[model samples]
Target: MQVLLRGDWRQRLRLISGLILFAFATTHFLNHALALFDLQAMYEVQQWRWIVTRSWPGTIILAAALVTHIVLALDKLSDRATLRLPAWEFIQLALGLAIPFLLLPHIVNTRFARDIFGVNDTYLYELARLWPDSAVLQSTLLLLVWIHGCMGIHFWLRLYAPYRKFQPLLLLIAIAIPIAALGGFMVGGRAVAQMIADPKTFDEVKQLSHWPSPDNADRLAAMRLIVRLVFAAMLTAALGLLVWPAIQRRYWPHFIINYVGAGSANCTFGPTLLEISRMNGIPHASVCGGRARCSTCRVRVEEGIDAVPPATFPEAVTLASIGAPQNVRLACQVRPRGPMTVTRLLRPSTASPADVDEAERGSEGIEKPLAAFVLDLRDFTRLSQKKMPHDIVFMLNEVFAAAGSAIAVHDGWIDKFIGDGLLAVFGEKHGIEIGCRQALRAARDIDLALDHINAKMEAEFGRPLRVGIGIEAGPLLMGRIGYGPNVDMTVIGSAVNVASRLEAVAKEKGAQVVISHEVARLAGWTPAPELLSKVDIRGVSEPLEIVAIPRGRDLPASLLASIEDVDERVVGRAAF
Candidate 1:
């Protein structure tokens, strides 16, 4: 119970209550849709619906959910450090806030009058009062409520991959339900209007409706006004809560923040660096908002690191996972305590929610063992000098496309394309052992793809294209780097550097692929002694042991076959 009062519990409560309210609204819309068959069909469905909805249990649950949802929304609004939000979020918020205001009169007339004034408030009574007169207002309310519910559902469900698969069908259903209900409502209203035009039918419906006397109707009107006034006061109080802090904090102690390269801004102590950036129009990358999930908003504290408090629990976990230096901090988590000088690690650009992947969420800010695959096209400068610029671009595109396809097939992420070279990372999801084998397989696939491409391109170009492939595995920090459209999720470590060096070595030795001894050991492969060699690598103190494959296709099949054998052995032991 105490846990429910703190941290993310409020968000959970809001979602659950909103879902209950949405369910109620859906059933109501479905009941309205039955009016297409005729007023009798609508009447029959409403009777059954009222049996459940008008019961004490249903009424209490619905009333509780509605009150809770609204209160939570207002509380969230009051906690906002800045009104700066993504466009979709802003639209959803606006629509949500508008719903209660538009819905109040209808609720007061129907439910309040039915309960307190002994009015029947049946379909006939509602249609006679609403048709053609309140039609537009009612339709507006229906659309707003439906749209707001769908947006909330979409934002929440999109976090799960399964929901994304059925989003198109779900969206179609969302659209069709409201439209059909609206059509039925209009059709039913017209039918009621025709009936009311006849004096005989009008007399029957009026008696059956059990409408209140004129004096009672006047009393109901005054009650509705009172209810509206009370609601207005509550709304005003919520807005005051939102605004009072901003006004009071204007006089709070301010701190100056100096961002290297970018300009500086002065702000009060409460808002985070990322919020301060947005408030001041400074470009900052925060792909996951300020949730401390994505580390895109990390900055190196160049000065005043000592004055700033250490990272909180969540921030510490994210920073440690990403192998962030002691001086580095997430801009979203760090509140400026005093004057500080910091450098933004990621450039600012427009980043959408799509930029974050749910499956890869856990790996975002982490150090893990990953295999690096670096491939460089050989003699590309000479080829470019011989060919026209367009021809060069076309040729490079084909090569890159083939290489990218091959890497993807083996579960590798193409980190970046460097002129004529490329870098890929493996083992983010799987362990390093499987990742090493996958890298070797990807290197072989790339070789085969290039062979096929050369067969067709040899007629246009003078000769076949050649590439040097290198594979290495070690603990590496993987993260999203750069800013704007140029951003890439890449790996950075000495292992990547060594992989590039091995690619150069492959070119120097005139071999197709060069892999470190570590790769062979991890992948469960034992190369012939004669095939192994020790070579000095640049920026390294000791000579490295490696294997140079003359042809990628020549890699022993046993390297992959061993994995099945190991799995079988484990299963066998478990069975005993």
Candidate 2:
């Protein structure tokens, strides 16, 4: 219900009508392709096609869909704040608008002639009339309709992952259907031309079609001309809307949209902030175009925020989902009703596949119970003080790689690499109990992996590298957070802070690993009573009871022996 409410009703209506028209076009193309088999086969399919399309209900439905689509298209055009559009969007629009003009003639000749003049419009009769002379026009019409419908379908489905995964297959089908239809059309036309060369066959086709009187034929031709002129006028009127925004900005009441740190755009009342940005060539990010389905186009109104109207239901829902402040609004959805200063929330360069995930993932930004693991390199300042910047970076990379592999072996997600340490979360899919167990196992593995690194680097550093590992389990809000390209999956909760504090405690006590009591209990591990101790942690009201291990190599061999090998797929999937 919420999803439906967030949808633009006009867009939904347009898609429905477009799909209906595309279905009609598909059936027509398939019927035409039947001509490859034989004219009799084409006739048989055409008859079945007409039984649905020529029926009273089908005719009414098709006509209603056509009118609805046209009216909504022109209405949307009239509402545009600028003529600027993405390349594919412009191409699709141009193709769609050109289709009606090309299609008018075809309809007037066949369906209109048959309905009004009682003309028997069959493949034999129409092919005889249109064979070689009007071949170019017919072929162009076929391509235009098919291309327009395919573009619409493409735009509609491209947001889905499944469509993108199978796009190559779909593209091949899109290409093959048109080629087959054109081949059938050309073959059938050639056959008609050969038969019509015989004067007897030509006369028979004309008589069989119940050739209309000269007066009725003239009337049909005149009506066709009149229909073409009217359609041309409508299209011209629609195109004329492009100039209205410029005219309004010059003479009508407008607003100055000040984009802090960039510039300002003088826009009329109708244009969205995003449209104004594009019109004036200001860079802004909008991964989902202006559909209000993604939050990338959001802007913070720094000044005169109260002057901006409230966000609509869809816009409000998106902002709320992202936990955006009250002053922020989607640049695409909000049309400035008054002068206001705004700041774009995202950089255009930050647009990426992650934005698509944000749009499609229903559980994005939700909270779940999980394990937070924090690790810190021991004596990191002393180790790096004597080394070159490049040398220090290389050493840190080696340490991170060892730690990262251990986390991965246990199905943990490496959230981010801190300067000398890292944060890893576990059990996004398997639950917190599994997560706690995985995180504890990963802690011991990290220590063991670093031992190998230490053996290699001991001669150069004069000492082995050491790290402090901390693990805590609790409910945490895990999701992507940060500005633009810096956005990353991270967890936030008391458990995260407690885990970090435990890492510090491990370094101070010279212990290889430290974990809150909750982690051990959740993982079902029973350490020695001597290793169990309590330490005061900042922000934690009570002293946290924890298990401290003096050496990672002595972290209970039974724990490792009892556990199964970690599933490779469990690692690096999500921040728990």
Candidate 3:
């Protein structure tokens, strides 16, 4: 345990160093935001900021954090065998690598120059030097650093209970602060440009910067040389990590990763699959950037699960919460110690095989035909207007209880409740035929359940409760929608919409249960020829044909055999 913690010290140090730097950067950006108010206010605030930051203890802490962060980052780059990263992580990495190059010049001219030459720095002096090209560089630098910091913080707190609730507010601040800073700088620069245009103000600014000194010119030249040398040295060190490992590959061992479902074999010398996937252009999802915060990138090891180390605390907690089997592991957190075959499990509940393949690039949902069942309690509105709120709520609870149970029994899900109505979907797992059949059975069962409920509640209500059930089975979209707080897993498309319209049609025509012709045909329930009727529906171009079934009991076995006979004749397959 001690050895494990010791080896993890580098990662811990990097996080702490990053947070300290982020704190400093945040304060600096906030100071820049003040420029939107008044340039003098910006300058005035800067004094107190500098007073705190430039103090002996502050200087030591800042310098130490900077060196530790840079050194540890370089070590990670060297240690890593693959360069695969999620889009945001890649962006953050690129920006982090660019920071020193953008920052060195500014740092040397101000922090170093102030210490060495006793230069009096002010807003006017900064404005003259930084306006135009330098302004763009500074703004880019600020944003890069800020974004990197924000990503780090997000990765750290993403799994925490409280952070998830307040994330929107954090996101708002993260976005608004940088924009305000950039705007503030532009406004301040405009004022400074006006100052420089006046000959008197220009001279004073130049004097403050100690310009025209052969000594100052030499110092500026020396600063540029130092920045170049530092950047080159860092680059060389990073490249060496990659080069040295490759040169020794023949002498060292390797690991083979067999993707059980992706239909491809891949090899990597590295430990982490998350990095290997990113580096190799394999489509994978890692919401927490490999920190094991969220389990969206989890995989089930088919073989050699024991070859990797046991789950760490974070991984264990996350896996247990989801009731993942012993074989399941987070791809980001697990780095195989030996060859392993694994399958990714972070897919939508209803995702098809094809959808899973495409979703590696992110969530591209599956489009399929499904049975959409829309059930609306007839005259619910009239009943609601007359009943007390509590009484109506009790009535609604009973309705949901009956409808929801029937949906579950038929292998369907209650999509949502609409006042006294409920929307359910079948074919989530089974194909369209069985889905439609299940819908028909569920509708019948719901009617029977409602009859039972009304029997017990006849004294409470003067009339029996009635419901209209509409069903349509056809091609539609099924997948998880949204990200962050807005995310949902459900089906969406024309079939769902048409099913909803059909429910209204049922209410309009005074039918207890109505199935679109498509569904009736699909479910193999060809009601007597005369039972089929026509009704106009919105979004559908022509008058829609439907079947009005009369029973509130099990669909006859003859219906299943008839449907199979039709399919065997047409598609040559008995589906149900």
Best by lDDT: 1
User: How much is 20 displaced in model 3, in angstroms?
Assistant: 2.4
TM-scores for candidates 1 onward, in order: 0.75, 0.71, 0.59
When 2 and 3 are scored with lDDT, the better candidate is 2
Q: What does candidate 1's lDDT look like per residue over 1-576, in tens digits?
A: 221121255677887899998998898888788888777988888889889888999889888888899889888777777878767778988898888887777888888888987778888898887898999999999999999999988766654457778989999999999998899899999999998899998888878887777897888778778866876787788788868877887999888898887889988877788878888888887764555655668888889897578887667766665567799898888888889988777657635444435213433456789899999998999888888899999999999999999888777888889999999988775679878988898888888888899998978888899889999899888766653334456779989999999999998898989999999898878998877998999977899999999888888877545446756754787899
Worst 10 residues of 2 by lDDT: 561-570
Model 2 sits at a Cα RMSD from the real structure of 6.8
**lDDT tens string, model 2, 345-463?**
66655354355555334224667898999999888899888888998888898999888988988878888788898989998757887788888778888878887898889888878
Each prediction's RMSD to truth: 5.5, 6.8, 17.6
For TM-score, candidate 2 versus 3, the one ahead is: 2
**Counting only residues 3 or more apart in sequence or on different chains, how many pairs clash (N, Cα, C under 3 Å) in candidate 1?**
0
Can you tell me which runs of candidate 1 are displaced by over 4 Å? 1-12, 33-52, 122-132, 157-180, 183-199, 211-253, 269-272, 287-337, 342-367, 386-398, 433-466, 474-498, 505-576
lDDT values, one for every candidate: 0.81, 0.80, 0.74
Candidate 2 clashing pairs, residues 3+ apart or interchain: none
- Estimate, for each residue in 1-576, the C-alpha lDDT of model 3 and write its tens digit: 221121145667888888899999998888888999999899999899988888999999998998889878777777766666656677877777888877777777777767777665666667777887588788888887888889878756654546768989999999999999899889998888988889998887888676536777587768867886887698788879867875775465667777655544355455477666665565666665565545667777888887778988767866665556688787877877778877765542312222322233223356777899998877777777877999988988998899899899877887667777777889766678878888888888888898789998656877888888889988777654643223345678888888888888777777777788888777766677766899888999999998766544545555434334544654755443
Model 1 Cα RMSD, 1 decimal:
5.5
Clashing pairs in 3: 84-278, 84-279, 369-475
Candidate 3 Cα deviation (angstroms), residue 83: 1.7
Ordered by lDDT, highest first, the candidates read: 1, 2, 3
Query: Judged by lDDT against the true structure, how good is candidate 3?
Result: 0.74
